[model samples]
Structures are given as structure tokens and as C-alpha cells.
Target: MIILPQSIAHVQQLIQPGENYYLVGGAVRDALLNKCNNDLDIICPGGTQKIARRLADQTSGAFYILDKERNTSRVIINESNGDRIVFDFTQLRGGSLEADLRERDFTINAMAVNLTDPVHVIDPLKGGRDLLEKWLRPCSGSSFRDDPLRVIRAIRYSVALDLKMESSTIQELKETVVNLDQISKERKRDEFFKILGRGKTSVSVQLLHSFGILPFLGIENLTNFAKVLQRLRVLDSFMSYLGNDSSLLKRDYFQLASFISGLGKQRKNLSNYLAQPNNSYRTRKDLDHLGAFLWDTSHVDECEVFKKLALSNDESTHLYILLKNRNWLHEFVENGGVLDNRIIFQYFKRLGDAGLDLALLTLADTASVVTAELNHDLWLLELEVCGRLIETWFEHPEVVDPKMLLSGTDLLIEFGLTPGPLIGQLLENLREEQAAGEVLTRQEALDWVEEKKLK
Candidate 1:
């Protein structure tokens, strides 16, 4: 393979022939491991931002200083194929790349592949060795302590890349992991979601449980999380969707809560955890919707937590509203109203996904509490049914909303009746009948109204 550099080329060309410029940190780590590399953070000797900025300007890229304290500037260049190429230039390395490489968090991320003149590596930190070994070893324990978010990053890397944490590093992380509180919540959220978006949020969920680090971040009781993962084998897949698929995430929110809350051992904590983010009061409403669905089904005690989580909202009102949204329950109800074309189209427009997801969520939630009835793979069956419902829903809009048929003018002229209350009522009824597929033509609609003996 040709050791080439679209990234390093820029750095090497800008700096003098034998000058000190090295492709350092994450780019080097990913390159050595043969991972797709585009974002490049270079550890230049000193007095190089001018050179870096000039290169970025020549390439018509954008450059901005991230932090003046760190003297780090980010250059964003767009590739011909519309891919983003980011370059990070920092002056903290003094004149030696080793000084900068050692400051990184993990061994795999601390490797520096030199780009100046003759191509060589300055792995004073052995980051390539650790990368080859599939190890998540920190450059130094105190290195991560300088930035506690790295503690979370370590856990994220383990799940995201399917790499194991070196035993010594895991022990080191636990020792200093508690200091993560020193990091801001926004930073914590950033690092946490990085793992989440990597399609490994569920695995990270499990890893957080294995180590005692999760409790420090406020998820002290993980019994529900642990059980939920085991019961619904697709727990990881479901969590994975949260990263890339927002529709599935929003659709599954209720079910995820219901399933986790169903664990039944310590019902309260799990419910609180679900509702404990972004506008707590309204978030509780989302959870209450899930709670009401499971309240009758499972013996999980969530009323008190619901009260604490909620801020003076009507609980029953919420229950009714959520039930209304979930018209799928109407499928199993005594009278679910007719499942005609009009109603199907209305459902399709209101919710992009079919009623099958709701049914599956409920089943999954029930199985989460106790695997007696839903232990089998019924989700596949639900998927097939939902596929048909979704197709029929999108096909027709007028089928769901009957008022599309006609108005008082059309009815009054056809029946030779004046535009009175009776005319309006008769026209609406005709629309309803048409919506229900009971009337096919204007003559048929008029005949039905006459049969009903409307004035």
C-alpha cells in the first residue's frame, strides 16, 4: 500500500523541508489501524498557525480558533467528493511532537505519524502497538484526569470499536472516573452521545453497568437497564437506532420506558431516570404516557415518581391523550371504530410508522416485566401486519377524512334544499357515509340521507 497523505501533504508542504510537523493524535491512531481517516489534528513544533491558516486559505477552507488558552485552531476543508477534511493545529508541543503526543488521553490516540521531509513516526507513546493489540490504554492515568470526559470516552471506545480496555487502564479509569463531575454537563453529554451515535450506545450501557463508573454519573440503580438488555435481545439494536434514526427513537421512547420500568424489582428509579432530561416537566408527560400503558399490565409502582417527575399536570388527561394517539389499542378494543380506508389514511398522515410498532412496543414492554406471554419472537409477525397497514394508509387520504366529498352548496343544489342546519347536517352525514365506504356516488349519498329520513 502506498503511504500517501492528502492531509499530511498540506502540513509537509507548508512547513520547511526538514521542519517539525507531525500528524498527531486521532488521525494517526485511526490511520495506523487502517480506519477511514479524514479529520487530522497536527502537532506542529511552534509558530505554525500562520502557516496552517495560509494553507487553509489557499485551499479555500475555513479556520477558527477553538480555544486561545490551548492555542488550537481548526481548519475545515471540503474535499472534491463533498467529504469534510478537518485539520487541528496546536502550538502546545513546543518543538517536539513527543511533548504533544504524551498529552493525549489514550495510547491509541497518542501516536504521531511524522509528515515533515523524510516520512517517519514518533511513537514515543507506543500508541500503534496498543492499537494493534485492540487495547484501550491511556497514554497516562493523570493524562485522562486532566480531562475527565476521556473517562467516558474510554467506555465509549470500548463499545463503539468493540475493543477491550486494558486491565491496568480500566483500573486507572475507575480510580479517577469519579472526577468526571469536574467536567461540565454539556461536555459530558457530548462524550456520552459520541458513543451513542457510534451504534454502540447499548453496549456502552452494559459496560457502564459492569464498572462502577455509571453510578457517578447519576444512574445508581441499573437493575432495569441490565434486565431490559437481557429480556429484549434487540435492546442494543433499538438503542443503536437512537443514534442514527430519530423516527425510531421517538417512536420507541414510550416502549423503552415501559420496558425498563417493567423490570419490577426497583420500579421507581428506572422511571425517574427516563424522565430526568430536557424540560423535566414535559418529559414526565412522555413518561406518564408509558406508565399508564403499563400500570394496568405490570405491578411496577410509578405513581409517586410520576408525581415527583410531573409538575401539576393531569395524569388521567395524559393517559387518555396517549391512548388516543395509540389507535392501535383500538384494534384490540371492544369497538375500535371501523378500520376503513379513510381512517387508515388519517393514521398514516398522523404517524409515519404503522400501528404495528405500537403493538410491538406494548408486547415488548409486557415481556420485559415477565417473559411468559411475549417471550416468543412476535415482533416479526407484527412487522408483517404493520407493513400492510402502512401501505394502505399512505395510498388514500380522503378515505380517513370523509369531509372531502362535498359541501352544503353541492348538497343543496343536488337535493333542491335550502342551505339550512338540516342541509349542513345532511351533507356532513353523507361525507361520513362516503368515508366509511357506505356511499359510492352522489345519488347513493342522497338516497342514504333520504333513507335516514333527514329533513
Candidate 2:
């Protein structure tokens, strides 16, 4: 039986009476699995643009032609409740709906249902059966060769949906995995990030490595793959806590019950904290996974293999910062350093909000190696350090990014200093002092600057 989401059913009402439209691809597979998907893919034998344009006009959605040569277009509708619905319209690839389904990437994704007769699933490739069996199979023998990126996508589906790869499909994937180099870097990055965004990133990374895919993505050293996986698994655990999924927590994870209890009240705060986007395209959690994966890789930003991923400057910088300072908090705890306003101020001064990112990275990295009996003391110390940093970031705003006690303009006007680097130096000193509480009021700031000037 084919199931249609209410949004897709509603979209069916917008198409003109006589046009033949088939709801295809992931939308069909998700519907069968009783999953919710706001994005829908529709295909027609001809005149896809006409149908797409009319639908956009009727729904007042923004329209754009995705691929003019293929007659593929898209309509994006913004609902009142802040939910987004995306519809992609394309002409059937081989002039017939059956032929089109046969040309898709995976069996589970190749199924379709005709909108006019939504009850009948048009599965020419037995995709629905594969879905029921929890197996990921190719639509045809050349599925991966036709689009090498599907190799990564197949693994993503497996990890995200808990589907086992069919034996033959796995063999074909191994044979075609090398051709993934022929695919563009941006496309590869998109697929890889999707895997990271999914929950079971450790499993995803392990599969990518076993399938001979990590080398193409610039991961060379398997010596640390075990360590990387451990760190990523720990990172996933933290992510589960941040996402409020306590059930996924393992029994042995009870060892860290004290740390989790400490964060109990700030769960929502931590959730909102990591939910923030690093750029227009990627979130802090996305980088969190990247940081874990590259935990041991040195000079991450300078590596050419990583350069091929074509990450944004902000993303690359964030990853670089996370990896570079992954051990700072650990070392601090090991040294028995105190968590004070001065350190917190300097921490955010160097890392900004990424101080929290570093805190999470350090905790996960530490947790990866913490045995049930070993390093318990160090682990508790690190947790105390991280908890203080996180609490200051969420609860005490002034301690992190304190109000500027003295500005460049203030220095120029007050001390008759010219506009140059000294003014900047003075302002920096004042900010540090103010955040440390050594300089509280404007008069105290002036006196501190005056003392420094006299020196």
C-alpha cells in the first residue's frame, strides 16, 4: 500500500485535472515507512514546467527552474506555522514512468505512486519489498556508476534508516567507490555532512571506511580510525543528551551520570546553544561531528584533502579552532587550573562562542578514553571545568563578552592618543581587565589605563 502525506495529498489537488504526475523517490519511500517528509518529488512524462509553474502560482510559492535542459523546476512554500514545503517537478527520464523508476539510485528510493491513483504503488524494481525487508539495494547494476555520489548516499540511507546493505549491492559499491573521485568536491561534502547530521555518525564513519570511501574524502590514517570512532560515538552520546533523547544513553554511560545531572537544568540551554548555525548552510552540531572525526588529524585546515571538501571559511575556521584547542580544557583540568573570570574571559576571547564548542569537544574526547575505573578523577575535573564554562556562557553573559570598559575613541579623547595600534592595544587590555573585574566602573577603567600609560 502507498501512503501519501497530507502535504503531498494537498499538493495533488493543485495539479490540473488531466495531467499525469507521479510522486517519486524518497518521498514515496518515507511515506511507506510512516515517516514525515515535507519535501516531495513529482515527475511527469512532459510539461513539468507548466505543472510546476501553475502549482507555484496557485500556492503563491517561490518558483525556480532547477534544470532547464531536463525541464526540472522547484516550488518552495512557506506555511504560516513556520514549516517549509518543497516540491521538485521534473520530466520523466526515459519517457515512461516505469523506465524512470528503473534508472534511480537505490531500490528503496525508486518506488513511486501515481497521484491520480495514489493507492497503487508503481514499484517496477521491488523497492517496497526491500523497504519491508530493511535492505538497501540498487535499482540496477550500474546505479553507483551512473552517479558515484550515490555510493555515499546509499551508506547515508543505511545509517539513517537502519537498513542493511544487500550483499551484491555492497560488492558493487566497493567496485564503484573509486569513481567517487570523479564526483565534484561540493557534492561529496553535501553527502558527507548529511551523514554527520544523522545521529549514528560513528557507524556512518565506520561504514564509509569499510566501503573504501574515506580515502576519497581525505581521511588517510586508519591508525586513529578506532580513536576517531570512539570520540565520534561519545560525541553522538552528548548530542543525544543535547537533543533530549535520554533513552539512547547506554548503561555504562551511567558512569557519567554526575556530569549529565549537572547539565540537567541547562539541557534546553545547551540544546539551543548547539542548534545555532555556524553559517547560512551549516550548524554548530555539524561542525561538532567534523571536529570529532578530525580529532587526531593535525593541521586540519591546511590539509589538501580537507580543502577538497570546499567548506565555507567560517566552517573551516571553526573546525580548525576546535581541533587545534581540543585538548586545552583537558590540560587545564590536568594542571588543576581554577575556573575564574580571567580564564573564562580569555577563553571566550580566544574562542568566542566556540569556547563552548571546545568544552563539548574536550568532554567528548576525554570521555572517549575514560575507563569505568580509570581516569575518573581527571574526568570529574574536566567536567567541572566544562560545566563552569557552559554555565557562564548561558547564564552569565557579561563574563564572556563583557561591556567595553574603554574604547579606542575613549583612549584617543581621554589620553590624547593618536589613532593607531596603541589605541587598539589599550582597548584590549581594558576589556580583559574589565572582564576579570579588576576594572569595574568608567573611573576605574580610566585609572587602569592611566597607570598603564604612566608605565
Candidate 3:
């Protein structure tokens, strides 16, 4: 009777006054950890469904039945006490605390605390030790064998909590990592991104590499996980810009890779625009940008590899342009070699994050190939740049202009040239210049473009 919520007087009324109630699972685990806990699974001494039905009747809660063979049912009560509370009604643990703990995933997750005063803790498995040591170990490898997703979960938690998985558990992962496909992609995606969102995506990726677990997914052929960590702060900050704040970097890789890929498509398209269809120069130029990304890394720079990695036409084009134009030291010197919000946002607006990702990877690549003696100041500058980029995307989304102030038609008529594509490019560049505060109005833009064309 005590298990019934205060609002459900009717359910409490229906109870002939003899049932006992106790808390269970994650709620208790969080309580034990002194972490904020919201899950409210409850164990009822008798007729779990009847308790559920009565509660549902009183509170509009839904009743769900589970494992009819086990005669178990769940009463889902969702209460909005300024926060969501799910009262999961279940039959008492089928066996002793030890047996109940044995049925769970990891040892640390198995422990639960009673909400009753004195806050009695139930630890039939040695979960307390694991939690204290910040270690992750499954109740048994058989549990993981039954459900292989736990393998990734361990890796994910290790990255998230900045902890490590126990040796025995790592062995279990190695055995199960290849069989991960048995699990649903939706589930795998969920787990994979959870690691990413933790700002430990690179860590999880690296571990995946270390254990040879990534080949299971087509996105393997990754170089290093530790490198991802080294690049984490910079990558995350830039991704945050675009109002797509994410710990997991969960946007479609193709969408992002397209944004990042610059050199190859740039040459193909750029050459076509320049009326240089016969020249192989653009292709070599594209390879050179890949070389920029690879210049400081160990791997031999290959143009095909860049093509494979590119996510989109735009990304390929821009990356190609920026790589060939890079004079980071020159840009750094002009800006006093100290990174700030204006500098970061300017780069983000000009190059987008993919180019910056390459910039970040360059540092890591250099260390792997050359020296670990990084300029700490450069690292701070990178992080500051990341924060600035993130802040700008959130603050200002790129809205479409109502109408362009100038046009290619105007350029063609005024300048006495054929109505060619460069006119459009000229107008677009003018708009960008105006947008960037380099010019203020159509008159100023026209004057600037007219002067440039006459040259």
C-alpha cells in the first residue's frame, strides 16, 4: 500500500493494506554515487500488474506487460514534478540480491540503494569496488555474449568518464567487437554518438582502432584514436559553430566530410570556370592541398585518399583553395600571432570547420611525424578559436539576403563584356565583401568591382 503514489488515493484505497514497496536500479545507483538520479523503478511484494492496473486507473498511467513466462509486468507512471519520474512497477527480484545483480550488465551498474532512511545499499555484486576505482567490468562475459552491445558501452563509458575498462572486460570486447553487427544499427548509432557527445568521441574512435574493432563498420581504415583526442578541443569547438552543438559530432559524416573536402572538386570546378579544360594543373593542385594536410603527417599524401574522404562538392572546392593559399605563419603574424574570437570566426566563415579540422589534424600529424613539442600557446589559441566559432554560429545564423544589391547583368552591360560566369562570381564576391563590412553599399561595391575589372 505504501508504494502507491500520493495522488492515487483510489489505488491506495483499493490496496487492502498489505503490500510492501522498495526502490530499484539506476535511481538507487545514482543515489549511491551521489549523482543526480531520476529513474524510479519499484518492486512490489504482490500482484505487480494489479498494482499497475490500479495505479493506471487512478493516474492515467499505462500498463505494460513483460516476459509473461516470468509473470512480470510493468506499470509506467510518468509524473511531472518539475522533472520526469517513471515509476517502473515490477515483481520482486526473482532471487536473492546476488542472483539479481548477476542478471545485469556491468558490475558498477548492478548496485542499487534503498530510498528508505539510513539509505541501505544493496551490493550483491562487488560493484562498489568497481565504481570506487572508476573501473568498468561486466557481471560476466556471458552477459555480453548474450548482448554484444555492452562491448561498445564499456569503451564508451571509459571515454566518457575518462576512466578505463577492466582487463577482463576488454578481452570480452575483443571477442565481441567483430560480432557487433548482430546488434541493430540504431542501437549502435546511439552508442557510438553517445561517446562522441561526451567529447570523448576521438577516444572511443582510437580505442576502436587499437582493438581493431572499427573494420566492422565501413568507416574503418582510420589512422589513430589518440590523434583524435589530441584534436578534440579544436574539432568540438568548431562543430559547435553552425548551431549544431554536439559532443558526439553526430552530423552525417558525408555532410561534414563534404564540407571538409576542398581541394579535388575545387580544381575540377575551378579549372572549368577558368576555361582551362585541357590542363592537368588543377588536378596536381588538388593533390598539393592533400599534401598540405599530409605534409606534417607520417602517411604518404595521396590525392585519391582525399577524394575518398571528401564529404561534398563545396567542401572539396574550399579545402583545395585554402590549402594552396595557406600561409598560417603569415596570417598569424598579421594578426599578431595570437588567436581570438574575430580571428576564429573569420576563419570559420571563410573556410568552414572541415578546413579547420585539417588545420587541427596538422598539429597532431606533425607531432606523430616530427615533434611532440607543441607550442602550448598555439593550443590555447586553437581552443579560443573553437569557442568563438561556436558562439558565433549560435548567435548568428547565415540568413538569406532579401535581394542581391547588384547583378551580373549590370556588370555585363556596364563593363562591355560577354554575360559570362565571372560576372556572377564578381557580384557574389562584392556581396561577400559588403557582407564582411569591407564595403557598405551597392555604390561602393560597384566602384570597387569597376576598378578591379578595368585592370
Candidate 4:
């Protein structure tokens, strides 16, 4: 018995008499797989815009037209459990539901369940059987040709469901791989992030590479592809390590996306490729930062890449700090694996709120290299040390960057010194001294400033 989610059951109650509505796409597929799915998709013959509006009004949800040409619209209902249920309504393509199913990208998504009779599923292309067989099969030969974006979508579903693609579908994918360039970057970006957002990023990426789709994303050479995939796997492990804490999992999407944004290819070419209007990512600022970090090996032209990508000042500064300080972990290991409090404090102070995020990235990078060399014990030790540093940073943040004990106004008033750039320098010096534990009290800071004045 395939049981529908509560949201789907609620939607079934909204189906009016004589209306030919069917629950379609991922909702049906996931239900058969016994997976939790909040997104509901429905297909109706002729038109869907008017019905979608009425459904939104009845459900007290917000509605928006997703694509005007195709008569696709969506209604978002917020559930009390903090999960969002999205109802996507689309007009039947080719004048009938059967035609619509045939036009879909994959067979698993082509199955539909009639809202009027949920028991009898409408499987025109044997998609239900494919779902049971754990195989991803295209509905037709022209599926990829009709929509080249399906190439990436195929890889996404393969990894998401852990299904093997039918031999024919793989052949179709190879034939249609070249047309991927014709697809809009927005579509590609969304699909790319969707793959990354899933926990098994490394698997999805390897699938894409194996299918010869990496070249379209500017990753032409296969030489460094394995290394990049290893890094992504390391990142996935780090995410799992921190998954016990809900707060960390909440931000995993952006962190994972940023980590793999510039995996393969170095030089301005990849940056140029990403900056193109068609290849623009969802979060352009984050992509630009990651791009700058990956390329610009000398770190001299990050600002140049930022300007080309049209990043904001704050975004540029954050990227700069991350890239500039990414090697701190390497330096620490080189210095006999000693945790120098001063160096750790400086890293936390420079990274500020992004301290933990950058630390994760650095740890993942180091672990990737160490694992490649088969040094499991070293990687475990590094993980423990980095975990402790991150915990201490959150627990005693004041130690990372303490409050100013002396102000510039106090310096001028007591020492009769003229206000100038030297005041800013003195303030920074005092902060460094304070962070280093050399100065702890306001009186000590004042005395230190007086001594500097005498010098």
C-alpha cells in the first residue's frame, strides 16, 4: 500500500468533481519509494493557471506563475512542522496526460496518480515498474533532445535515488551531452546546486564526469578531476561529522556548494566561463569567491576576478580573508603540529563569524591530501585538533578578539598627541597585545600606550 503524505491527502480533498487532475512527477515517485516528499506536482488538461490560483486561495498559501508560456504555476503552503509543501500545477503537454507523460525527461517521473482515484496509478510508460526495478529510463528517444537540461537531471536522479540508468538512457545521454551548452545557466545552476545540496555530492559529481558532462562545466582535463572529487568526499565526511548538531546541518547547503564551486580547472578561463550570463550560479557572490580562491594560484588577482564577477565589497572582503588565511592550517602543521594560541587567536580574529566555516574548509583540504597519501592516523589527529579549536572558538570567543581597553580619544586626551593615522595603528597594536595575553586590563593598556608615546 502506497500511503501519501498528509500534504498530498489535503490536496486530494481540494479536487473538484469532473476535474481531471492527477498527482504527477516526483511526488508520485517518492511515495512509491516510501520517501518523504513535501513537493506536490499535478497535471491537468488544457489549463492550470486558474485552478492553481483557486487552490492557493483555498489553502491560504502564496501563488506564483513559474513559467507563463507552459502554463506552470506553484503554490507554497507552510506546514506547522517547519516543512514547506510546494504544489506545482502544469497544463498537460500535447493536449493529453498520456502525451505529457511521454514528453517528460525520465520514466520514473512520468507516472501519475489520479486525484479522484489514488489507488489506481496511471503508468502509461511502465514507469512504476522501472521504479520497482531501480532503473532510470527515459520516456522516449527525443527526451534529451527535447530538453538538454535533462542530462544533468538524469545524473541528479541517479544519485538521489541510487538507481542505475538503463543502457538505452545512457546512450541517449551521451548523444545529448553536447547540447547541454544550449541550456540556460540558471537551469544548470539550479540542478548543480541540487546535486550538491544532497549529501552524496561526490557520487553525483563522479557520475557527471563519467558521462562526459564535466567538459561543459569548464572542467576539461581529467587529470585533476579525481583529486577534486576526493576533496568533495572529504567535505561530505566533514559534514557528516558535524551533522549531529542541527545548526551545522542547516548551513550545509551553502557550505557544500561553495566548497565545490571551483573544483577543476585553474586560470581565468573557468572564471570567465562562470561569469557568463548563461552560466551564472544561484548565489553569484559565493560562486565568485570560490572561483577566485580556486584560480589565482598566486592570490594576486582575486580583486580582478571579483570585479569581473560583479561581487559586492563585503563579498570580496570575505573571500579575500578566506583565501588569504586558508594556508594557516598548513603552517600550523609545518610548525610541529603545535597549537600556538597566538596564531589560533589571529586566525579566529581575522575570520570572525566565518571562523568555523573556513576552518572546516581548511580541514577538509588537508584531509583530502592526507587521505590521498593513505595517512589515516594523521587525518584523524588533524580532525580532533581542528574540532577542539572550533569548539574553543565558540566557547570563549572573547579570547579570539577582546574588547578595546583603550580608546583613541583617551590616547589624545591623556598624552596630548595629535589625532592621525598613528592613533589607528596604536589601537590595532593594543588589540594584538590584548589577544596575545600581554595586556589584560584598561590600566595596563593605558600604561602601554604611554610607554609607546615616550618611545
The local distance difference test score of each candidate is 0.55, 0.82, 0.52, 0.68
Regions more than 4 Å wrong, model 4 = 9-15, 44-62, 244-325, 337-341, 369-381, 404-429, 438-455
Superposition TM-score, candidate 2 onto the true structure: 0.92
TM-score attained by model 4: 0.76
Candidates 1 and 3 compared by TM-score, better number: 1
Worst 10 residues of 3 by lDDT: 276-285
Q: For candidate 4, write residues 18-110 as lDDT tens digits.
A: 877888888889898888888898887657777778878887888999999988999888778767788998887887888888888889999
By TM-score, highest first, what's the ranking? 2, 4, 1, 3
Q: Please identify model 1 stretches exceeding 4 Å from their true place.
A: 1-19, 47-52, 55-60, 78-82, 165-167, 197-200, 215-223, 230-381, 388-455
lDDT, candidate 3, 76-135, per-residue tens: 555666433345666666555557667778877786543332245677777777777888
- Give the alpha carbon lDDT tens digit for every residue of 258-352 in model 1: 43333333234333333343332234323332332233322223333233223334543444334445435434332434445555555544544
Pairs that collide, model 1: 342-399, 342-400, 343-400
lDDT per residue, candidate 2, 186-213, as tens digits?
A: 8899889888846888888998988889
* Candidate 3 ranges beyond 4 A from true positions: 1-23, 37-100, 114-118, 133-137, 157-173, 197-207, 224-229, 232-430, 438-455
User: Residue 227 in candidate 3 has what lDDT?
Assistant: 49
Pairs of colliding residues, candidate 4: 185-278
Q: In order, what is each prediction's RMSD in angstroms?
A: 10.4, 2.4, 13.2, 8.2
The TM-score, computed over Cα atoms with residue i paired to residue i, of candidate 1 is: 0.60
TM-score of each: 0.60, 0.92, 0.49, 0.76
